[model samples]
Target: MRIAVPVFPGSNCDHDAYHALKHVVGVDTAFVWHKRSSLEGFDAVVIPGGFTYGDYLRCGAMAKLSPVMDAVRRFAEGGGPVIGICNGFQILLESGLLPGAMMVNESLRFVCEYVHLRAETGRTPFTGGIAPGTVLKIPVAHYQGNYFADDATLAALEERRQVVFRYCDPSGDPTAGSNPNGSARNIAGICNERGNVLGMMPHPERCSEEELGSADGRRLFDSMVAWLKEKGK
Candidate 1:
């Protein structure tokens, strides 16, 4: 299966996503510019993180207006798997592909470091290969990674098992100290109700290899592959 990594003007993680998919994970992958209007040949889409449109106006606010997002919406509507990381997560929220909005890090500063993420569910394509409660060591870097939603919406997400990951300590306890950006309920990632679309603040590509000091993130990518392979059968 082939993967598409969308590249916005300031998307620094585009190469990182591409490298992880094509080199580390041994999957066919290609870069898709933000102007492109189609995702026809791709099996899955990964929007890498960066300051799209320089995070102008608001984080991902301008990016939601880009032409590529329309195609992404259509692709996602058709049940194509889509995963967005960090700034990409912001874009997904702004574009309405995912629920919730990003807020400034509770610390009021850009946080850049490794944190543990506990898998909250394994039903989604992105987490299917991982066991529930598995802790992944991934890095997150952003000033607005905190995620928030209305109490009703948050309740729905929890009730439907849409929450996919939560920031946690190594032992897998979601606690105040383990939350890098103070995301709601220490949430680090979540998926749409259908589980085809996911947005998260962590940068899995940054830790997909042992050389990067962790391979835990690779399980996420590998999980997507496993899901696709199963469907293709």
Candidate 2:
């Protein structure tokens, strides 16, 4: 599998994302700067977690207009697999690669720590290895992670199984109180209508090692690599 991880001015997690793919998954990974205009021959792309552009202009709003995002948009529209984590998720929303918008945390403060996420979709390449209701303990760190959409959109997402993860407690019980940033319906992740584009608030690469207390995040990346291999065969 070949993965392209984009790096913006303040994209602190790009290296970690690249490491996870290169070391944990043993795949060919490259760090692509935001100025680049095309994605070349990569099979998949990961917009890693971080405070891009210092989160200066509403989380990912500023980075959304970066030159590389045009290619990212093209990649997603072409049905290529694209995963956006945290700020990357925000960029997807801003770029219209995915639907909805992010808002300030209900508490209006930054949140950072390990949280629980329940898998809500299995049809996407990103979550194929995880069963429905599979509970993953992953780390989430962000300030503007709250997700919001209108009633019709939310209903459509639920009806289509486009929602991929919901915030929950360690016991696997969904709870708004457990929500790290007050995402609507406790949603921590979602996929585009076609299921090829995914955006989530949690950092999967951060939990790829057992030493991080959970290896659940690895399953997401592993599933993508395996899915690609299967497609090739």
Best by lDDT: 1
Off by over 4 Å in 2: none
Candidate 1, residues 80-103: lDDT per residue as tens digits?
999999999999999999899999
lDDT of each: 0.92, 0.91
> Per-residue lDDT for 1-233 in model 2, tens only?
57999999999889889988999889999999999999988889999888888888688989999999999989888888999999999999998888899999998988889999999888898998899988999998888889999999999999988999999988778987799887889999999989999999999999999987888899999999988998891
Please tell me which predicted candidate would have the highest TM-score against the true structure. Answer: 1
Candidate 1 Cα misplacement greater than 4 A, ranges: none
Clashing pairs in 2: none
Q: In candidate 2, residue 14 scores what lDDT?
A: 93
Query: Which residue window of length 10 is worst by lDDT in model 2?
Result: 49-58
**For candidate 1, what is the TM-score?**
0.98
